[model samples]
Target: MALVLPFEPNEPSIEALVALVKADMERVNATILARTGSDVAMIPEVANHLISSGGKRLRPMLTLACASLSGYRGDGHVKLAASVEFMHTATLLHDDVVDESDMRRGKLAARKLWGNEASVLVGDFLLGQAFKMMVEVGSMTCLDILATAACVIAEGEVMQLAAAKNTATSEDDYLAVIRGKTAELFAAACEVGAVLGQRPKAEQAACRSYGMNLGIAFQLVDDALDYGGSQAKLGKNVGDDFREGKITLPVLLAFRRGDASERAFWQRCLEKGEGNDADLDQAIGLMTRHRAIADTVERARHYGAIAKDALALFPNGQAKDALMEAVDFCLSRAH
Candidate 1:
């Protein structure tokens, strides 16, 4: 007999997920704060600069919610959830330094405030603490999952760097970059929960698929929103990707669809890195003409459908529904 949980319809929001895991999230929050502490003042200071920044703690929440949904009762999920967040924060700190980002979660980036060296060192500190928490969980499976995710994420960063400012990047190339950079951790976060719950191998695989597809959808929407959404919504300035010469899906599609003049414009702005603020507007215009942003959102919707289907094995329940709604939330960010 298949197991069935509970469910109720709600608006397109993450409120359901947040409400479902509110208690566990509180513990995750505490663990995050506790782990951020170190004898060196700058460690906590730099870590907190980004950690305290008001980005949605969605990755940790995904860990907690997946555990609850998997019927996990032990407290190990808390530690794992905190570890998940620490990994995400560490990535963001490193990414900001690498991207030369000016803002994060609407505040000055840690690299800007504390210098790149401090930011990188503090990021390493958080990663070390994250591993310590994983060890305390005593789950070798969980440790292996996160550790591999860390490596894949680093590889993704390097991949993105290699692809940077190159107008010839393909959709497959971009997918490879995002899969490593963003989706791997999300997959690990959800899979570890199923592992902790001692769910069957099939169910564990299903959870990983859900997180992976959801993460791809999440990043696709982010790429769309980089040119289409507001800073208030994105927690960073719009067109930052363009300014950084990132060849996202929207840009790829637009570049592929554009004429010689349009291609030359992209070559100058992206390949040559010689654009100004006005070029951003022109890039958006070109994207609009090519339906690039629209198609990117459409691509996200395709993954979102897969994400929802990935949960078919888990009966309809609050956890299931919340996880499903998170896909909607990711897609909705573009609007």
Candidate 2:
């Protein structure tokens, strides 16, 4: 079947696709609220602050969408979606604290509002709720998948911490980092849908492939946006990653290709953390000069192509079409 491009009429907007699952999404939202409530007032207060913050809920939305495609007729998908959301939310809460970020989605980060202790505890609470939801589904397949993903995500954060402020990180190391932290959940979210839908192994593998590549592409775009995106889009100041000494693909490529002078520039800014406004500007210029941003976008497009190709196994329909649209949307951020 021919792939449906995002702008094509056959390719529904994210809005229309979300509307298709509106009822299910509502159920997921209710489940999230009920699960987030706690005896300790601080728990709900910190949890809901981040929950209420604006996020597209893309991971859970993917769970619902893939479930629809798999022809799941039970209520399991709703709980699974909620589980996916809680798992994702838990990650975000911990991530902000780890990253020492003060803002999230254009507002003060939950950690900034509440101390790091509350943020960590609330994040732990969310993970507990996520696991409970997984058990409620009584699907061993789902539980194993999500539980493993959570562990890998934690490992990824540790790997990133080890790599931080170290300019010697390779592209392969960077890929491993994103795979564990970001793409693992995406793969689990879609794979669990196939399990719940009872599709054959081949279809489940395809969904997993789609989610994995889509997630890689999504993270790649965010890396690009870190240097190029505005505060409005990124929810944090631009160039935050550089300031944090986090080595991403753009930085990786630029560092590899730079001359002695350019390498020293990266050393001073990223390694020594001695950069100022001019250093950030120079970093961007160096990346541009080395074509790092352009190359990074190219890498993201390659993954996006893989994501679209994974949908080829499934027949052309609204679910498949919307999935393709979502891939296009991920790539569009590069523009």
**Which candidate has the top score in lDDT?**
1
**How much lDDT does candidate 1 score?**
0.92
Q: How close is candidate 1 to the true structure, as a TM-score?
A: 0.96
lDDT of each: 0.92, 0.88
Clashing pairs in model 2, backbone N/Cα/C closer than 3 A: none
- C-alpha positional error of residue 107 in candidate 2 after TM-score superposition, expressed in Å: 1.1
Model 2 agreement with the true structure over 173-236: per-residue lDDT tens digits: 9999999999999989988988899999999889989999999999999999998988887677
Estimated TM-score for each candidate: 0.96, 0.95
User: What lDDT score is found at residue 136 in candidate 1?
Assistant: 100
For model 1, the superposed segments whose C-alpha errors exceed 4 Å read 1-11
Candidate 1 displacement at residue 333 in angstroms: 1.1
